[model samples]
Target: MRNETYMWKILAKTEPEKTLYEHTLDVLTVLKEMMKIFPDVPKLINEPNFWDYVFYALFLHDFGKSAKGFQESLRLGKRWGYRHEIISAGFVACLEYESEIKKLIALGIASHHKEIDELKSKYSTHRKNSPGYERYTKALREIEENFGELVEMMKLIPDLSEEFIGKKLTNFKIPNSLDELLDVFSFAVKSYEDSKSSGIDRVVWLKHVFMRGFVLGCDYLASSGNLEIPLLKNEISEIIRFEKFTDVQLKMQSEDMKNKDIILVAPTGYGKTEASLFWVEKNQNDRRTKRVFYILPYTASINDMFKRFVRYFGEDLVGMKHHRAGYFIYQSFRDREYTPDEAKKFANAFVDLSKKIYKQFKIITHFQLLREIFGLPGFEMGISEMAGGIVILDEVHSYDARVIGLLIEALKILKYEFGARISVMSATFPKFLCEVFKRELEIETFITAEEEVLRKISRHKINLINDSILNGVDRIKKFLEDGKRVLVVCNTVKKAQEIYNVLKEFARGESKLIHSRFALIDRERIEKSLKNESVQILVGTQAIEVSLDIDFDVLFTDVAPIDRLVQRFGRVNRRGRLNYADVFIFTGYLDDDLKIYDKELLDRTISELLKVQRINEVDILNLIESVYADGFTQKQSKIFNETRESFLRLRKEIYPMLSNKIADEDLHRLIGSIEIVPSCYENDYLKMRESGNYFEVVKFFMSLAYPQFFKLHRNGQIYQHSHTLFCLAGYDKELGLLVDEFETNILE
Candidate 1:
């Protein structure tokens, strides 16, 4: 017989060798913490004994690791053909749980490490003479001996039976044969998958998936005991307190938004954020809402919103999540006084905890929400968490047709399927898009800025210039010479850079250039500087479109889509204090401008702007409607339909497969953006890596559109260093990433 002490050392490691008992206890503690954070998890599943089932699963998840053969494999660092999850599933099958509960627990245990296909493949074949069979036989015998010991250990915990188990374990039996065990496991897998396919009792399906995700979360926290999972404090005080609401915000508050979905259309700086927050606050008492997800389209906007929300809701209640969330959390840690090592640890812990237990008020990109709808791995937990939450879709107009289609599907699932409350807001929500929503989701609450307020916010004097961007350079210089804060917007990065180069020489005040190609850290720094600087000549691309709150006295922009043009105009005279600000709309195209932007849309935008010498907020909706009256073109409609069809296929067919057929990288590629660290920063990157502050330095990495990255790669202007792409092209500390003049294929 194996000694208990020997069994305890079976899964030993030098870093931290937690005994099986200690690990189990740690997992139990984590489960309790998770329960506290999501107090209504049990209610979400509508299972009174949900916690009991979870406790049993957690206790037995690692039971198979106790097998003597498995222990020897771990000790010798040998490849074990069979995983412990299969053995644990066998043990779970012997439990006295009813058929349905046992099936759920068994499937969860078996799938803890491997998905369904791998599990089936491993167990489907049996070779009695194989080493795998010998190990399996030994593991079974060991489980028989240790089963009673586990029961005895459980009794030692205070009120274990009364509080969790609900009864004392006296009798249990292992499957009489290996075939029987395999058969039982196969049955559970089939039954679970079948139920999921049938869509019978979605609550039951959610419960099973939630249990799997919860168990995995607990197992991870227990194994890597480096972090404490922080629970979100969801008191009413956690709602951001506003001193006063603007006129629009006041209207939002006065309206009855309880238990209703809303679509609010307002101009920039019209208190849209406050209005959404107020609506969430008014419905704060609703039991259906588990948390709040304030979704934005861009990382910059998400970061800005995260900080703005942190001020209203304390830092502890708000979290910023994105591809570079680790970097953000690291920066937050660096903001305080901490040792280098301490900061690294805290940053890692904060990120881990946030992912495990999302904060009450989360500022995240829409991709995160779409991930749940796609039913990827660990998304079950996300779906459950967001099922009854409030989702605020900010800047809904910024996404392309493909993304807009996915967003609409995700909203449908969130609102109609999961009982979530949704509020979609944009500075320029077009009538065509609104009609689509009304047709699809039947959204009734449509709020827009009052005509008077629109008139007040309509502070731009529009001027159409049927000339090249070069012609606008002199106008930009004139604005800068007059001491008027000048903002020049280009349709592409190359144009922006060219225009910035011209304005830099002639500017009387500080000149700055910004675009999507700059590192996130640099872009953020520039944005911060722009906010503080009163008079400056700022040049940028479409990066200036949404959620950036910088205001200027005059604007020079290339004519594009009406909605995009409106977004650019919003940055000028943003406070509505001036009688009117000048906005010069250059109508001629630059290099690849026609390819980048639809020519017909540009023509329509120019035509519409020519009609309105003084453009206001009310003019925006009508202009957008006119531009998008026919909806998506043939190619765009095809892309949108394909994207939506793919989503449905994944959710219905592919997701049910035992294996995850869709890769996250594939999805990211579809998103068509990649983050790269410039070669010039390689030394700093290496130094940061060595100093254990890599996460802090990650913010400086620039994200490039796929076409741009490919162009550089084709010219041998980009290099790969340590999983990051480094561009050999020139980059300026102040001007940001620049396009070399020699490039022939400039992403037309």
Candidate 2:
């Protein structure tokens, strides 16, 4: 007999040599902390005996690991013949409790390690002659013996006394026969199936997902041995108070936007972010608006917004979710004074917690929300959390037609099905696009900057150059020579790099190149360098179009779409202090122009630019409406219809039938991008991998458009170095990836 007076002996170990009891305690602590931070957890509190049900699930989540077979497997470093979750589920079923509570506990335990499909297949037809029946029976006998020991151990631990586990369990008996054990397991599985299929009992659905997610979150946090809770300080007002509001912002605050979706059309400097935050604040006290998601199109924009929101909401309450979110969290942690080990531990914990719990203000790209819409694994909880929240979609006009259609479908679901409120804002929202939303949404409040306000912000004088983009080099040199900041925007990465190479020689001060091809860390450094006084000339691609707050004295850009050109011009003379900044638009080469933009739209945009002498916020909006007045072309219409149909089908046909396994590749393809690490960073990548600094290593990777990457990869220009790293032979340090050199007919 084991010593009942001594500490409980080990049953299993999450980490090598770590005791199962220690792991259990860690999980319990994490569960408590999560309940404090996660907004959705509070909804469950109103349920009768909810806390008791939660405690029961957490207490017995790992009971099956106490089985002798499992313990032996852990000691010998071998795989157990049967899953411990099944044995754990059987134990929960045997407990004497209300049938509903017992079923919830059993489902939580059973589905913790595997999905419903895997669970069903494991115990189906549990006959003696079945392939896995012998192993299953042997595991059940071992679990029965371990169950007795667990009860004895619980009696010794003060926290697991009869009061917490319930007095009804004092005479609890393990199923005496295998047939009885199978029956209990079958009932638990059927209960879960019924709950999922019923679909009408939202309360039951929420409880089911919350219990499963809570258990898994606790288990993961405990196994990692990082128990620190990253919390946001309650300082929403401190961040918002420092800035003086403009007229647009004041109007936004004075208006009543609670419970209504909004369409805000304002210039870049009109405090759109502030107005959106103000709207959120107005609805903050409402029970429906529990969280806010600030959605942007680009990763850079998301990162920038995350930092800005952190300043307002504090680091603890604001979180970022993107592919490089881990890298940003690591950077935030590194900014503080911590020893190497301490930094690693805190950064890991921060990343883990932010991903698992939805913060009060979450800055994310559309991909994160799309994951929920696609019904991906582990995202059911995310979808549940998003219900009754506010989602702010910035740069609404930037996405292509297919993406626009998909977003429209997603918005329909979010508004009609999930009860989420949406606010769509952009500097150059077209009339046609506005019509789409107005027709789809039930009630939308449209707000635009007054003409007087736009006139006061008018800041740029336009010039058209019929020559090649290189012809603008002389103007760039002249601006730099005169001690004025100059910005050059190109339509393609190769053109931007070429222009940068030539202008760097004539530049009087700092000259930097920025584009999408550079690694995330390098791009971040470039963005920071833009604010340096010594940086006189900045050359970039469309990346300079939005989110970046850099202001310059002059602009030189290649001709493209009208909205894109307006965004580029906004980067110069942004504050309206220069009276009139020079914006020189040069036409790209014929092949290059068609490759980068729609030929008809490019023609119309150029025609409209010729008509305007001075470019202002109102002029930009007019030009956008003129270009899109005819709506999408026949081909574009086909693509949009197909995309919309596909998404609607997924929502109606596939979503309900989906199990835990989501087709991630299909979603990535729909998004038209993929993340890869260039071969040049192999040495640093290996060093980081060996040092276990994965989050930091992600900063050195870049996102590539799928069509470009696929074309290159098929031609043998791209190589897979490992699961996470890919090598592109054409990647250049200064020029970035040469995507245009080899490509198909795909257009962005």
Candidate 3:
């Protein structure tokens, strides 16, 4: 017989060999630390015994690991046949709490590892004489044998009364059968599913979501070592210095608009970021901590904003997220002469903390926040983090129709359900999009720069060209020869490359090409190169529309949608330093332009631009309204409506205690892009992979859209190198990927 006074030992993690009891204590400690940071968590839940439910869930979460099979698997380094969360959830029945409270705790424990629906689907069919039942019965016996020691640990919970603990422990019985355990687990599942109903109390949904989200958050943080989740500080006004507030900035800081969602229409140089920060400052206070998410649509923009925020708030308080965040982190650390492994470790740590609840201000790509609504991995924690947060959406006009539809649905939930304060600001926001937000998000505030202020900046004179932009190579040469800084924008990467090739020979200054297809290292180099005064003639595709701060003397470009055209035009004479600059829009384009943009939208954009030769800063809004007057075309409307409906339906299906695995594939498909190594880097990539230097391997990758990926795959120009895809496409530092050269490439 085992000593009754003995403490039963169970493993929570190996390699470092942490015990189950130690892990439990760690998780509870993290919960306490988190509560200290986010003290209003209870108030947000606004439910009685919220802490009690969460505390119980944390302590009992790993109890099932004490089972015999689980212990053996941990000791032998083999996979456990059954999930520990299942048996751990069974303990909820033993606690002498109200049925609803017990179910809430059970739900938190059961769904912490897998979704409640996953558990139900896997074990709901188990009955007498089944293998699953036998497994449960065997595990119960092991737990019952060590029940005394488990009860002794229960006394360690500081919140529970001694008398209550004694009474609960004395009366506790090993579950009579597997049905007792199944019934308790089923109750939790039913409770969660019921909370998803249309008529359920909003508070009930809040409780269920917080319960599930907080447990996982605590568990992950506990396992990740001691990391404090910081709160937004009331110090932005001191850090960001300005000579005087612009009219738009003052309006944003005004008390009258303090509690309302806003649409701020300000031109590129109108201090919109500062205005948004002013708005964030108004919403932030000492009473309660709210997160501030500065969301952008592009990776380059996010990186730029992350650095800017860091300077204002300090590096400890600001975090950024994007697909290439790890790469960016690695680059930053490497610049400090850190070792490869050190940089990699720091990058991993930074990314992990950024994704979790450690930061006060998160500068992120919109997809990072929007992906959570699709129920991507760890979304519960994301939702919990976003509750009562301030979201600043810059460049609201940048996204396509489907993305717009998704953003609308996400805003609805974040506003109504999660209580997020969303501020949508853009230089080129259209009237139709504004109305959409007003109706869907119930926004009441529309702030714009004073008309006089906007009118003072007359920047671009529109030059309509009725021929392919590439056909006017001699005209581009003339601009370069005339000693002017020229910018050429195209609708596609191929077009950019074609124009770059023809003009580089006659270039008067440093000529460079930039697009999305370049590898990370080259892309960053080109982006930085734009800041140099010598880079006078720059050619690019849609990637050049925003996030770049360079000012060019003239712009020659394809005619796109009005919003995009405005963005391109803003790049030239960006600071109003020039009295007037020319933005040449090609009405006729090579076949590729039609494939890149809608024909109908292009026609409307051309019509509006032809009506006025000079595009005044104040008249940009009118230009956008004229082009987008009818809103999305029929095809665009269908895609928008279908995406919105699908996501809203998916939102309903995303109840507490469900698996993210269900939506993982759908999210991946939605991105419809991948990263691959260019043939030029194949040797270097293989060396890194062979030597286990994955941190450096990522730098050689270039992102390829699905269409380009398919074309390369069909031509047998790509091959799988381990898990990394290698493409035989030609690449150059100045011109980027050369798709036309692929026909001559042979893999040696």
Candidate 4:
């Protein structure tokens, strides 16, 4: 009897010898890890009816992999792997559970192999005589027959109300948008139908996809040496282990919570993302509303959040929003359920809002919000409704003054009008904002432990490198030799390229140059590289500062706004490690026009960091305030000062009735006056973007630029641009020609 049970013994062992059980556990591990990145997934699944369904779906996604047909018992059958999911479904149906559970299991197994829409499900029933029908009928019949005995072998389901089930589905389906749920379901059905002739039945639906993805993700994670899934009772140990951060990091986290909206004003290399999440985790998990919106300054940062979110939340839950993050977003709003006319009316708004993201507890990126705000025609109504959410603006200090003013006011509006919980994170927040938050929210979060902050700072070193490009490269070369990683940042793509080219020639060890111009795939490649190395050399645009959290030893940066300079330094020696390298800042002369155009900010920034090579948050912010003491931010300075003053006046004028009692038209009219160009577009720009005859995309953009979104070549238009994400174009006049124009978004 023992010999006969050897297979069971094999399965019982911790080491499963690369069998289906091992693979299943691997899937579970990956999903568990994915949950860390997307910490609020349980909330997403808290829905009444589907939560249990999703739970089991996640549990039994691949229970049937051990079935015979799926094993391909012959050598020749290896390549022609049968639709194991169908076989898997049959096995699941054989389990003694509720019909829904069996169906859910079947769906999870089938959909993972081929998503629903890919199966052409909607058309399956009548689209053909014997085609789609054969697989559907056969698979359904087989599952029913096989699991029939299990259905007789019973277990009672908890009695749930119809209303509760509907409510849960509404919450589950709503955030992902009602339309998305349908599409994903239909996609599953279609994919199943499409594969009919190939010998499969029904494809999976949304619940299954989420479940299987979770299961598969969990399975993948179990294999990782650094990660382990804590048992149910061991969650406390996991939290404690995660919470075992530096005291300084914890203190900064506390300040952010106590203060309404405060910046970290530290260097970049610190664990800010984790720091912020730690803050959120500490606060509360009412689990009713989504709590975080990590508005990364860069899409690359968003991608970092994407990985991090998956690490925290669970990949199945967190959705990355960017113009180009299609894997998790709608492919084309103009297809099937939506029309061109509908696309024009609800086109961009629907596209932006219809993502399956609302179901998620965490969101990443401010650029997506910017795009959704720029709704096209009737699309405006829906997009405007997308507020009342949490917003975390990381690297806020990296923004220019005008942009900063706009972001601050926007947050206040989102807070008052939309019930948003806004958190602006930076190592160099201005006192202006601290007061702004106090005035806006009644409560502000500031971490004021001077000795603690100082302790964190003492572990850091600063160096200024304002020499030519060659000098910066040489300095970086020397830094790299100390076995410390070095990051070189430039103001322009060309400058970054030049430094990268120079570094390529001299650096013997690992070195890489990354910028927005090289295509998005290229940028992601470089970022992935940075994550692995210790003492490597990296030169890029401001992309490295936000989400690219490599434990760098030193940093070198070009001249930038004072707030931005603080953020740049924030990137160096930030993790409270004395072994960290110093930051060498390099400043060059700005043109007279640039200085004049941004006179107050230019003066403030320039005066703040005189040497560039050696400065910290204190030095930079002090210089900024001192430079502004001459009344740069005062009412007397007309253009910008007046703009800042006007922004405040507008907020105060509209602040009182924030209880959803105000009218939408009034809100739009109020927002219309203090204009910041939206980062997203409602135009056919995306469809036009791929028409890629080069000039075709550009011409298409210009032709449609007149009314809906912006007039062609408008200077103030804040485009939601990306390196591999979004881009904006504008006209130039130096040689009477237009050049590639840009706005600050993510790098990748």
Candidate that scores best on lDDT: 3
- Give candidate 2's whole-model lDDT: 0.71
The worst-scoring run of ten residues by lDDT in candidate 4 lies at: 173-182
Model 1 CA deviation exceeding 4 Å by range: 1-52, 69-82, 96-100, 114-131, 153-208, 220-239, 285-289, 656-658, 690-692, 718-721, 741-748
Q: Write the per-residue lDDT of candidate 3 for residues 267-287, one digit (tens) a residue.
A: 888889988988887876564
TM-score per model over all chains = 0.86, 0.84, 0.90, 0.49
Candidate 2 residue spans exceeding 4 A from truth? 1-60, 71-81, 91-106, 118-128, 148-185, 188-211, 217-239, 286-289, 335-341, 652-662, 739-748
- Name the top TM-score candidate: 3
Q: Give the 10-residue window scoring lowest on summed lDDT in candidate 1.
A: 1-10
lDDT tens digits, residues 36-130, model 1? 55555666667877766777777778767766666666677775556777677765655676788887777777777667667666564245656
What's every prediction's RMSD, in angstroms?
A: 4.8, 5.4, 4.2, 16.3
Cα distance off (Å), candidate 4, residue 748 = 25
- Ranked candidates, highest TM-score first: 3, 1, 2, 4
Error of 2 at 200 (Å): 10
lDDT of 2 by residue, 1-748 (tens): 2232656665658445665566666676766665544443444434655545656667667777877878888888777777877766766655668777677777777777776567667664345567566556677777654555566554433344233333233434444443455333556666556554554254565566667766766676667665655543343334577457776676567647766788988988778899887776665643322668888998778878888887676776677777777767677667876665676787767666666543567888888888877877766556655656678889986888888888888787677656677888888888888888788875468888888767766788989889878777876788888889889998877788888999999888888899888877777788888878688989998888887888899999889888888889888888878879999988655676676677888888888888988866777788899988988756677888999988875654222212743477678789887777766676678788889878778876888888768776777657655567464545556667666453221121
Roughly what TM-score does model 1 have, to 2 decimal places? 0.86
